[model samples]
Target: MTRARALDLARILFVLLTLGCAWLGFRGRGDEIADALADTSALGLAAALLVTLLGLALTAILWRRILARLGSPVPERAASAIFFVGQLGKYVPGSVWSFAAQAQLGRRHDVPARRSVTASGLFLLVHTATGAVVGTAAVVTGVLDAGGPRWLWALGLVAGAVVLALPVVRRDVGPAMVLMAGVWLAYGVGVLALLGPARAGLDDLPAIIAAFALSHVAGVLLVIAPAGLGAREGVLIALLEPVVGLDAAIATALLARVVHAAADFAIAGLAALRARRTGVRPSPGLRPADRRTDL
Candidate 1:
């Protein structure tokens, strides 16, 4: 088979594997989720969803900053749309199509593919790093209690730290990592807001944040399923189950995904509409957004 075809097949298999994991995980908690859903007030769900939306918006802002740093300067609306659309590819497996999607969108406005990809990579790296630090602290302090092996969190932190340090290694680090940390902090605040009274205290907040963030990054890195659906729940539960009950944390994670999905599609649809109205086409590859002018 051609390389492209083989790659596609691999992605399909991974996606299937992820879905299977999610199914089994949920199956184990099927009755629990149902019970929680039945008891969970629509108001609470709404609050959680709102918090998630806020996080996504913050993500858009973060992406906007990264693009700006690269000289692309995507409009907030466009950045938001590009972000959400790329999210759709999370289910696609193997390929980091989300990054490709964002870079392609930037090209319409003259962004260079390399610069765009670099910015995106840097943002992701920092975000994951921040999550790692936060998640580990949480586990150490006993915030989340999901029952996975302890070594996983250690491995995640080490990997994240390595990635975060890559810019220094290249001797030409950019603003991408800083921008990622800022956005991630904002998102963590949003998540805490969703928990309200159940949230971790000021003293424990740092650890809680780290645990939650690391769990999230691990889920994405695992790349087993679309959007880290099951992986997210498992990791979060492992980390947060102590502070929050397993059922509650799992529910929150699921609810967060739902909100993210809704926001993603909503923004993507608008982007598609705008693109059609403006007669713009997606670029052929990922690149930086400001290639028209020399930086």
Candidate 2:
């Protein structure tokens, strides 16, 4: 009945929810995931998994940065655990679970609920708004690849970055925007890795990255599908099919889902293990107010 005991129980419940959803998600779609992985070479899968993991880590770091801006900086290891574990909630039925889980998970590390929730919201906004710019730049890159000047792609990308940065030029969100831009690029490469060299060359990577960015932006905007399952893949297939052919596009989309989910699971499981072994706590000098707020 004590507040501390209540919080500990709630934390356990949230982690269980995330892990359970992850289990059901894999159980429900294992066949499709296996087929997708089977289509790619072992090397391709390895590369995709590596990049996806990197992207996931960057995403966690992005959230950590946002929390720091909100005056609740957490330790890197604990932040990683909180973030990747919280991310498991995306497998559940709604987008809000991930945010909610992160808010509760932060309690163990001394982050206030308001700070964690605010960071989650800002993280989503940064991810999406920057994603739109990244997606648009990909279109520019695609146009140049198709017929226009090849060098213009760089110009287009700069334009897109500037557009996103100008409005938030002095705001704390600016760096987070920059980091999300890089995260999208990393994930785009993860998608590109699923393709064969013959199917998509470096020259074509920009176009592929564009399509990937656009698809994810669509996924974020469409809140109905958990983790952007149907909508993301659908948009990806539609946009990518033209460039990579229908068969290759569909395979890439499936492979992307499998690879991305693997990244989430792998990182979360690893972070969980790390937290268990080390027994993490709040950063030194955590505010008394933060300690009291979330409880």
Candidate 3:
């Protein structure tokens, strides 16, 4: 098989692995899911979905800010759609479909494939780092009780930073870092607000950060899981149970997945409709001349 084919296979395996993990997580634990679902009120689920959508929108804004700093700015509508649409590509395995779609759209905007990939990578690294910092803070200050296994936060940050600082990433690292810091500050405030009465005292900050970090991390890893079915719940049970209790955390993760999938469907559906109306042929990758065209 070719290099691309090998990479694709790996992603498929990741999806399978995620499914296996999720199965193991819930195996013989039917009562756990039953209890979690029973406690999950419709209002609570709705609220969780709203929060997830809002968080993703904020992420889109962050992406726009980074792209502006990169000199290949894409409008918010296009960027947001691209972000949502990209979510569907995880079904292709190896996550290549996401990159492939990005490259295709970027090319339309006249962006080089390398630059497009770098841009996407930078956004991910920054987002992950920001979440890690916040999650670690939550754990540290007693806002969350998972402080014992807090090494994961530090390790994730270091690994993210290393990838971001690599030579290829370095070309855009300067601007990306600056934008990321600003965004991180905003994100910190937002989550603190979410924690509301739960966030008090500086000691609680690290643990709060850790919770947010773990939540985001869990969401991301869901891409490799089958339709994100059990992966989110598993992560909540593993990392968030100590902080928020298994039932609440599991509900939160499941609700988040529902919202994410809804957004993806909404965005992709609109894109498809628009394409059909406009009679524009859809290319498989990013073209260089599409930067100014509206999606």
lDDT of each: 0.58, 0.75, 0.53
Tens digits of per-residue lDDT, candidate 2, 1-295, equal 9998987687677767766765664576667777777777888789889988888888888887767766787888889888888877777786788888888888877777878888787677667767767766656645323334645645645655664564433365556666676787788788888986857877777777777877887888778666887788888888788788988988888778777877887899898788878878777534656532210
Where model 1 places Cα greater than 4 Å from the true spot, the runs are 1-35, 140-162, 168-208, 270-295
Clash number for each model: 22, 0, 36
Worst 10 residues of 3 by lDDT: 191-200
Assess candidate 2 and give its lDDT: 0.75
Q: For candidate 3, lDDT tens digit of each residue in 133-244?
A: 5555555444666545656655765666676666645665566555555544443333333333332334444443455566666656666654434554465446655645
Model 2: how far residue 246 lies from native, Å: 0.3
User: What TM-score does model 3 achieve against the real structure?
Assistant: 0.60
Query: Each candidate's root-mean-square deviation in Å?
Result: 7.0, 5.2, 8.1
User: What TM-score would candidate 1 get against the native?
Assistant: 0.66
Q: What number of backbone clashes does candidate 1 have, counting pairs of residues 3 or more apart or in separate chains? A: 22
Of 1 and 3, the candidate ahead on lDDT is: 1
